[model samples]
Target: MVFRRGSSQSWPGLGGGSGYTASLGMLRAAVLLVSLPWGAQGAACANVSMALGHRGPLPGGRYLSIGDGSVVEFEFPEKSEGIIVISSQYPGQSNGSGANPMLRVTSLDTEVLTIKNVSAITWGNRGGFVVSIHSGLPGQAPLHIQLMDPHETPPVLIEERRDFCIKVLPAEEAPATRGADQVHFSENPILYLLLPLIFVNKCSFGCKVELEVLKGLLQRPQPMLLGLLGQFLVMPFYAFLMAKVFMLPKVLALGLIITCSSPGGGGSYLFSLLLGGDVTLAISMTFISTVAATCLLPLSSAVYSHLLSIHETLHVPISKILGSLLFVAIPIAAGVLIKSKLPKLSQLLLQVIKPFSFVLLLGGLFLAYRMGVFILADVRLPIVLVGLTVPLVGLLVGYCLAICLKLPVAQRRTVSIEVGVQNSLLALAMLQLSLRRLQADYASQAPFIVALSGTSEMLALVIGHFIYSSLCPVP
Candidate 1:
C-alpha cells in the first residue's frame, strides 16, 4: 500500500464538503416512508423504508402523497437488496376497524409478491435494502418500486411521482490489470511509503511497559509533545524536499512525501526498547501522533495531492475514519481504565499480550510477505525509489526532529524510533477497501511495496534500537 499525501481535503467532509449531508438526507428519507395511511382512492402507493433490527425500535416514518391512476416511481439506494414491507391505512379508516387491505410487490413491473391482511413486521438494519414493487406497471426508470391496493370497482391509482430523491451507489469496480498504465504506479510511485504501520499498535503497547518503568529519571516530560508534532508534521516536508533534491520521478517523489507525513506507529515502543531509550515517551508519542493523524493525515493527503499534481482525488470513508478512533484510542484508554481498576491484572495482561503482540505481528508480516510476493516483482524504478526513501528519511528525520524538539539524549533516542514507525498494515486494509485503483493500477507492485515497507520498518527499529542502546546504557 502506498501513501497519497495532502489528499485529506479530497475527503467528503473537513473543508466544508457536502458529501456527508447528502448521504444523511438519503438515509433520513428512506426511514420516513415505512408506514402511511392512504385515502379510499389510495390502494396504489409509492414509498420506501429501511430494515430495522429485530426487537429494536422502528425508524421514523416518511410520508409522501400520490394520486390514483398516476404512475409513481421509487428508487432505492444503490446496491440495496432485501424485502421491502408495505402496509396502508385508508382515509377515514380507524385503527382496529377492519377494512382489510391487500398490496402486491414486484420487480421489472412483473408481479412478484402479494401481502394480504397487512401485519406488523420489520427486517434488517444499518445498510441498504432490496426493492420489490406491487401493483402498477414497472416503468423505464432504474428503480423497480410500485405499490397498488385492490379496491372495489375502479381501484384508485397512486400518482407516479419524480420528486423523490433516491441515490444509486456505484458498483464496486474490479481491480485494474494494466500494470504500467495505472496512475498510482507509473505516474507516481509514492504510494509504497506506508510500511511500518503494519506493526505499530502491537509493538507500541509492548514497548510501553518498558517506558512506564523508567518515567521518573527524565529531566522533563511534557515537552515530548513538541517532539511528536515535529515527528509527524515536520518530517514529511523534509522527505518531500529531499525527494525533489534527488530529482526523483513523480511517483517516487509522491511516495517520499506520504512516508514522511504518516504519523508514528505503535512499533516505536519496541524500537525504543531496543535502543534502551525512553519507552514510555515512545508509546505516548505513538498514541498522540495517531490521534492527530486522523485529521492531519487526511488533510495532508489533500494538500499533497494538489501540490504534487496528482489529479485523482481520494475520499476518507467516514465510517472507517470514525472506526479508527474507537479502535486505537478507545482501546488504549480502556487499557488505562483496566489499569485503574485492577493494576495487577492490567500489568499481567500487558506482559502476556506484549510478547503475543510481537508473535502476532511477525505472523502478520509473514502473511503480508506471502500475499505480496506477486506484487513484488512488478516494482519498477519509481516504486523502488519510494521503498528506498522511506527508511532513509525515517531514520534521518526521526533523529533530526528529536534533536530540534530538544528532546533529552535518552528521550531523543525514543523519539527517533517513534518517528520512523507506522501502521502500514491498517493503511493497506484501508487502501484496498477505499481505492479500487490500488488493485487495478498496481496489483503487481502493491503487494511488493507492502512487504518491502514492512521489512524496512522492522530494519529501522532494529537499527535504531541498537544504536540508541549503545549510546545510552540503562542506569
Candidate 2:
C-alpha cells in the first residue's frame, strides 16, 4: 500500500515482459506492441473519468475543465461529504486468475479534503472505483488516483492520474434579510457582551477631551492633517505590502487590510496621555479619523480585495460606522457641555477618567484573551509574525512622517500612537457582518492578533517612558 514518488522501478508482468519498467517509453512501446491504444492500456484504466455521485461524466474526462492549468477541480462545501465516482471504459486486466488491479486514491492536502473510503468495482472484466471525499477547510488540493498491479511484491502503478483536484468551498450562508438598522450578535457571545463595555470606555475617554486644545488645533490644522494622512493613507498601504511580502492567504490578507484601513482605536488617547503626547490632539485625531472611515474604509478594502482576487461582495456596515460616530460625538459634546456648565463635576470626572480607562483596558485584555484562545487556536506562525510587525511599522511610518512635517515632539508622539493603534473591533464587526460564520471567525484572527500586539507594544513603550522620566526628572 506504499506509494513512492519518482521511483523508476519497472512495473513487471505487463505485455508479456518479465520485468517491464513503467517509464513513459516502455509504457508507450508496450501499448504499440500489444495493439493496446494508450487510452485502452491498463484495460482502459488510462481513459479515466470522474463524476459527482451517480451523475454524468465531467466535461474533460480525467482532465476536468473546472479550473486552469493541469489540474481539474471539483468543489465540495465545507464540513460536507460527497461521493466521487471514477470510472474507466474497460476493466483492468488481471495479472493472474481472480486477481483485480488495486485502486488507491490519496488527497495531497489532507487539511482541505479527506479521502474516507475508496471502493473498487470489478465484474465481468469491467472495473472502476468510487471515492468518498469529505471536506474540511475552504481550500484546494490535488487528488492522486493510482491503478496498480497488486500481483507484484509491491504494488506497481499501472495507470496514474494526478490532474484531478478537490476544492472545499466555504459553506453557503442564508441570505441576510435583516434591515440595516438591525444588528445580529450571534457569532461570539463573549464579544457581544464586551461590545457595550468597549463603547462605554470610549465615551468615558471622550469626557477627558479638552475643548481649548481642540480649538487651537482647528486654528492650526497641520498636526490633524498629518495624523489623517498617516492613519488612512500610510497604514493601509503598509498592510497591503506586508500581506504581499508574507504571501498570506486571501482571507488573512483581507483581514489585515481591513484592520489597517480602520480608524484610530479608542485607547490611542490614553496611550498619548501616558506617553507624554498631546492628549487633545490624540482625541481629536481619533474622532476625525473615525468620521473619515465612513468613506475611506470601503475604498481601501475594495482596492485590496480586488488585488487579492476576492470577489465576495463585502458590504461595509454603514449603520455600524454611524453608530461609532454617534458614540464618540455625543459623549464628547455632552462632556464639553458639562465642562462649561458643571465645572466641578467635569473636574471630578477628569480626575478619575485615567484610572477608569485603565480598568476598562484590563477588562478588554481579559476578554480578548478569552476570545483569542478560541480564534487563534489554529493561527499559523506567519500570521502571528506579520500581525506583530504591522503596528510597529505604523508607528515608525507615522513618527517619520511627523518629523518630515516638523511637528512638535508631543504632536509626533500623538500621531504615532494614533496611527499605530487601529480600531480592530470595527474591522471585526465588519467581517462578522459581511461574511459567513466560519469564514468570519477564521478571518477574525488577524484583527484579534493585531489588537493584542498593538496593546502590548504600546504598553511596553509607556512603561519605558515612565521609567526614563522617573530616573531623570525634567525641571
Candidate 3:
C-alpha cells in the first residue's frame, strides 16, 4: 500500500469517521456545522467542544444551528444514507438541554423519523436526538426535514435553512454509517516510508518456496477447484449478504466485497507452517490466486454490481496487478537461486525469515494504523463481524472441499489456511487507488475496515492453532 501526506478540517460532532453518510451538504456544512454545535437551524457560534480536554463523548457528525425554530431541507437523489444529529446544547456541555430542542424529519411530506424532547438515552444532552436514515426514490426536487417547537402552531418554525444544517444525502452521493462522525484522515510520513516493506516481507516468505511441490498442482488440478470456487463465489457473496443484513453504508459494504473477492493473503505459507499444513500447497494457492486475480477480481466485483447501489464502475488499477506478480516472482526466484547455490545458507535463511514474516506482517499493520488511525477506529461492528466470519467460513469450506477430494491431512490444513487468509494487502492497495478515482470518502473506508478485520481474524486463527498444537500430544 502507498501512503502520502493529507490535510483536513476537523468535523464537529462524532470523534472518529467510522462508517458512511450522505455527503450532499457535507463539504458546504463542514465549514460552519462544527462551529455551531448548539442552537436552532440558521444560527451560528464558535466551536465549544474543543475546550473539554479532547475527552469528548460527542460522536462525530454534522451539526446544525437553528434560531428558536427553523426547518432544514435536503435536496438530493435516491438511495442516500446518512445521520442527522440535533444537539440541544454545545457538545461540551455535560448537563441539561440546550433550550428544549425539537425536530421532525420528513421526505416528500412523509415523516420518516422523529426527534422530540431528548430522553436519558440522549446522554448529556437530555432533549437532543441523533438519527440515521436511508432515503427513498429519485425525484426532481429535494427532501425536507424540519426543526420546530413541540408547542408551536404550524409545526414549521422558520422558512429558511442555514449553513450548519444536516441532511441525508443519496447513497452514491453519501456514505453508509453506524451513527458515528465522518473520519478525518491526515497522512503520516512514517507510514509512507514503511508501507512498501509489507510487500517485501511477504516476498521474503516466497523465497523459501519449492518448485517441485508446484508440479503436483500442474499434474492434478482437481484440488484447485475448491480454492477457485471459494474465492470467486462464496466469499464475495457472503460479504454482500453481511452488508445488507447489517444495513451497512454503501462504501463499507463494497469494501467487504473487494476483500472477499481477493485471493489468499501472502502469509498463507506462514500460516500453514504455523499450523503444520502443506506449505507447498499454501504457496501454490497463493501464487495461482494472485495470477488469476487480474481477471477474477473485476469479474467478482461486476457480479455484485446490481447490489452495489452505485452508478459508476470502479476502475481497477493495472499497476497493482502487475506489482503483485512482480513482488511474488522476484523474491521466490532469489530464494531459489540462494538455495541452489548455497544449501547451508538457504537453511539458515529459512530459519531466520520464517518467523520474521509474522513480525513484519504486524509491523505493517502498525504502519497502517498509524497512517489511518481514525479510519480503522471508524470501522463499525457489523463490518468487523463479517470480516472475521468470511475467512473462518472460507477455512471450513476449504477443509470440507479438501476432504471430499480425499486430500491428506497436511494438504487439508494448507488449503484451509490458504482459503481463509485472503490477500487483504492487494485489496487494500486496489481500494486506495480506486477510491481516489471515485467521489465517495466512505468507499476508501469500506475496504480498509475489511482489511483490518480480515487480518486480525487471520492472526487469531493462527494463534488458536498454536495453542491447539501445543496442547495436543504428537503420535
- Please name the candidate that would achieve the greatest TM-score relative to the true structure: 2
**Candidates' C-alpha lDDT:** 0.44, 0.69, 0.56
Most accurate candidate by lDDT: 2
lDDT of 3 by residue, 1-475 (tens): 1111121111122221222222322332344344332332222222212211123233333333322223444333334433344444433332332223344433331122222211111332222334333333332222243445433554445222233333323334332452233333323455456546654554445555677877877898766667888787888888888888887655566777887788857667777876778766776777788778888998887767666644445666668777767776677666677778878867776776656767866865665555445455545677667766777787898888889989989888887777777776666666666653232334555555555555677677778877887899587
Instruction: By lDDT, rank the candidates, best first.
Output: 2, 3, 1
Deviation in Å, model 2, residue 314 alpha carbon = 0.6
The number of residue pairs in model 3 that clash at the backbone is 27
Give the alpha carbon lDDT tens digit for every residue of 22-84 in model 2.
243234333332443222223222222322122333344432221122235665667665555
In the order shown, the candidates' Cα RMSDs to the true structure are 19.9, 10.1, 15.0
Off by over 4 Å in 1: 1-232, 242-256, 338-347, 350-354, 426-451, 454-475
Write down the lDDT that model 2 would get.
Answer: 0.69
Q: TM-scores of the models, in the given order?
A: 0.48, 0.68, 0.61
Superposed Cα deviation of residue 209, candidate 3 (Å):
2.5
In Å, residue 123's CA in model 2 sits off its true spot by 11
What is the overall TM-score of model 2 with all chains considered together?
0.68
Per-residue lDDT of candidate 1, residues 1-475 (tens digit): 1112211010011111134533563443344333322320122223232222122222233221222212243333222232233322223211222322222222221211121112222121122222232221111222222333234544343322233222222334544653443333223333233323432444335324443443552445443566556555776676566656655544344444554555555455655655557766765666667667677776776676577655444544446445554555555555555666667766676566545555545655655555554345455665566565565556566677667766678777776666656555344443444344433224234324634674557655666766786798767
